[model samples]
Target: MLDFAIFAVTFVIILVGAVLYLYPSSRSASGIPGLNPTEEKDGNLQDIVNRGSLHEFLASLHGQFGPVASFWFGGRPVVSLGSVDQLRQHINPNRTTDSFETMLKSLLGYQSGTGGGATEAVMRKKLYESAVNNTLEKNFPMLLKLVEELVGKWQSFPKDQHTPLCAHLLGLAMKAVTQLALGDRFRNDAEVIGFRKNHEAIWSEIGKGYLDGSMEKSSIRKEHYESALAEMETVLMSVAKDRKGQRSQTAFVDTLLQSNLTERQVMEDSMVFTLAGCVITANLCIWAVHFLSTSEEVQEKLHQELEDVLGSEPVSLDKIPQLRYFQQVLNETVRTAKLTPIAARLQENEGKVDQHIIPKETLVIYALGVVLQDADTWSRPYKFDPDRFTEDSARKSFSLLGFSGNQACPELRFAYTVATVVLSTVVRQLKLHQVKGQVVEARSELVSTPKDDTWITVSRRS
Candidate 1:
């Protein structure tokens, strides 16, 4: 009886080992150590859903498997680089084109390519940069006006009233992007409100649907999402038609019209930019203020810097660069919050990271969340210390993470400028205080925001 029991145990062990060895090799195209698909068709998709978000799943995946890892995203094998060295190997400095466009378009279900050839893409890229430059340089007063209005509203609130910080920031961001990118049509309160409603519907779905195919599964939800997208596109199309053939680069749509892109291409680009711009700007401000509210020292330092740079004067574009400490705090907020936690670029040619060979057309994910909080890369990485950004090594790590110098995306560049202006304006006037016993937890979606509506009260500073 003892001999028979031993044989049964040995047989079960052998079977388990065989399945582990054979099954993963079927899905894992490279030698990169990571997860295999639990199911054949869905790949590691359900795993992502179970783990909360793509960012969370990647964090755990990299924790188990070293820096460079692999996982099946649908049928395609995805290679994720989670450390500075791995990211350096994957990013190409010569390639100045946008990397997130393809991934974003895929998630949004926008099928049209950004023109047909490489030349067309390059033309569009130049026009995009021109639009951003023109929007900031030519329309500085409009941005300042918007910030003043927001601050005025905050001041109107009764002293010690707990203001809903996220809602206000989201509204301000919507107004800023729609007015600056689209046109004055969005200046109407009704138009801005309607646009915000649709933006919320689409963005909420895009974040959820990217992880699970649940949005498409329900006919009602699928129709509602498509309807919201169509409505936003219609608004963009009208704006484009109004600006067609006009040489003035006042708004983003006008600048794109100056190029040879088809109206459809122009509309698509505008939608992508508007969607990305609003979410990023809103959450960036939310996290920055929330962090500052928790730390009085950080707030005092920012206030001191504002006094040193511009005493009792509002922030201007020319003066933004001189406020180095303010920029450092913003940079630190981005790192600590993992604001835009993930970004991806498709490898067109076969590439090598360390010893692993990446096949052509493989999707390479930059796991920015894991790298942002890596202990080796940043000391006390989880703590909200802006001083860490003052070091050369810390700056290099952030550069490798793609938030510095020429690597920052246009939307981020826009957000940084807007945030600098907004945060500086508010901190100089009012002191932000967190509501007692209110613990804000991050809900990592396309952008990391507080899981619930975050609230803070303001007291006029003396």
Candidate 2:
């Protein structure tokens, strides 16, 4: 009778699992009227993967289901918010916190059971900002040297020869960010290469967060992933140990060591900064060069600006703030590229947007895909015009979701300084032109990048 009972229970468990898999609910978890985000075919996650990029997928859903939609990612329900109004409504009005960090935390598996989570988050952000500022200050000389090396390489290339800017830019950014963020952890060229490999292993898997059960599926990938993470922590902990009392303006690890966060916390934060610092910065550099290659008028205007304020002078941080057109170029590039595409938050309590209820713990994603190109916010939404970012126009365009304002990604802000150095150093020396008949296509990875190589021909300016 006991054997029969055990067998019966096992059979029932399997039957329920089958039922749930075969017939997932299309309704809201709370069963509230108007609360349900519009569902695709059978409310399954296959639609997302079918749509190609997360950006493309979100746009398709938003087009069909209005500004807000519901989709499942391997049985997890997520609400996609595509409109600026929806974002304003969902995010705190005062802008105390943001969804970018939430999405990052989700990706990193950050769980702080400590109370005052918001306060802790803010504190950590300040710490990161402080580290970036110090690191940039000390590393500016090194950064310019790297930029010079890139310039020399470009100038060496025969005229009309195509250069793969993405790969070159990634190498440059990898060098700059690692030197700045990791400090003594990567002491030599060989050590940095090893770190870069391990970092890429970890960084690449971050995108796989969207791919369900992928990390566990491959033994080789799993081993590499584990080894990369462990190696990073080991290097970081050693640096942290060495630099406990000593502080260096160039060392992010030193700043982290001085922080109140635990060694593990510091390691995690370093990993986040190291990866985030390099990838998006490389993307920005690639696009900036691409746009300049395509637009001679903008290039000439930027060249003129550089000539006026920065003629043959050492590029410095103070000079960075004075370059208004340069700032506008960056703004336009970020708007057009949508560099960091999506950010999300969790609803702590029940809320409503235009009579539709959002139940507690709902995954609220800010797509930023459609909204950046929204006609109401941007004139000639498809065109790249830096002039549209005048002081009056700038105020209205202030709240770009992924990489702008007080709410912007901190790494983006850090990248901006380094990127400016790159742009200034390069443009001052070289005139960039598009490779004839070369087409650059932007695709979304963890960082949105050129699907094909971004080819540019550089000629030394007379």
Candidate 3:
């Protein structure tokens, strides 16, 4: 769902900057309260940078301006909604269109099938979402096998050995997503390693490029980014070509290919899924473990639930929903971490969010980080209490924030299921512990992650 983080906010500014407009200096056209442009072209760009991240900026912006707020992006009007009421007014939970698909494609520079009619667009969206589910469902055993391989490695580690949580999970996620999306070819360690290198290069470059406008100014950086993108695309294209006219398990590429989507469409979707799926899945696991490591009560509760639900059995797809408290732990972890702190959608037409009048084509930001931790909505908002999600209202609030139910992005849905399996498998057998004297603070960026590489240790449970 938050697949938009790497490029959405910065992409909006760059896209709007190309077609300049002069917004009023004193107040927004929508009559919402916000910062005026610091410069004619920059708008409140410097303000966002000074605040460190768009998520951080929106938190402070809402704190001062209330639920509905506005800001200028390169002289264009941008509105941000920070409360549940404001979010419901702006985004319907049942909306068919997927906002992240648009933003992610724009950032990836993949324009295939973009000009299709609404029917075609909706068809493709359904195909993408279904493909994710199909991949996970059909490849459930492979998912378990891949995760178990990682767990096995950890099992062999010495009791005092501290693991590099982020790095390890990233590798596991890459293996899982690539193998499941692109098919069995990714089972080869060399193939997965090469793809990971290119993926990391492209991902890092894109994040840095959008943040500082480096891609435009530094020819070398641009060249590197393009080279990595080209290499990755080449790999995806090869896989897509091979999948053509071949009968196989309904993996992501196969589903897209079997449909009416063009070859370019298949390749674009494959690359997008691979990139977005791996990062989100990895970070979700990272935070889930990080939180579990610090709280023994939470861990014990989760372990007890796992015991009651599975009782010496490994996690299977059917048994997942039965692990209710485990789900709550993951949900609360997502809330506390504010993973994917912000998401955005463009206003299709003039709309009203509360009393504010949003204009057509306006860039609307969902200040999810602000809403997720709002005290009025969640009791002791900053506290990581999974029990808070036991109520039906918490689930509804979470869905409204686009982190649950049908409203969740395909990436998030995929991550949730994957995390369910991994956590159920690992935590069922090992007791996770936080590294002594180590502090992990979240760095709110494209994906929220620990400010540094987090280290954790695990001991075999008796």
Give lDDT for model 1. Answer: 0.78
Residue pairs clashing in model 2 are: none
The true-versus-predicted C-alpha distance at residue 65 of model 2, in Å, is 2.0
lDDT of 1 by residue, 1-462 (tens): 000001111112222232212334465668778888777655677798899887899999999998999987556577888988887777753143544554566566564265457676556656776888788887789999999889888888888899898889998899999988987888899999989989989988876653456765688987898899999998889889987866566888888787777888888889888988899889889999899999999999999999899997778889999999988998999999998777776667788888999987666777888888988798998999999988999998787666876656678888888899888989888888989999888877667888999999988888
List ranges where model 1 is wrong by over 4 Å.
1-27, 92-96, 111-119, 245-249
Q: List the residue pairs that clash in candidate 1.
A: none
Worst 10 residues of 1 by lDDT: 1-10
On a 0 to 100 scale, what is the lDDT of residue 110 in model 2?
Answer: 55
Per-residue lDDT over 125-171 for candidate 2, one digit per residue giving the tens place of the 0 to 100 score: 77877888888877788788888888889989998898899889988
Sort order, TM-score high to low: 3, 1, 2
Off by more than 4 A, model 2? 1-43, 74-76, 93-102, 112-115, 184-187, 247-249, 391-395, 398-402
lDDT of each: 0.78, 0.69, 0.81
Per-residue lDDT of candidate 3, residues 1-462 (tens digit): 442222364454564356445555565646778877677777777888888877889999899989988887776777888988888877763244555666667677776346766677777778888898788889999999988989888888889899999999999999999999999888899999999999888877555466545567678977888899999999999998887888775688888888887778888899888988888899999999888988989889988888898888889988888988988988998999998787777677788877778887777888888899999899999888999988999999898777887767798888988998888888877889889999888877666878789999989988
Best candidate (score: lDDT): 3
Best by TM-score: 3
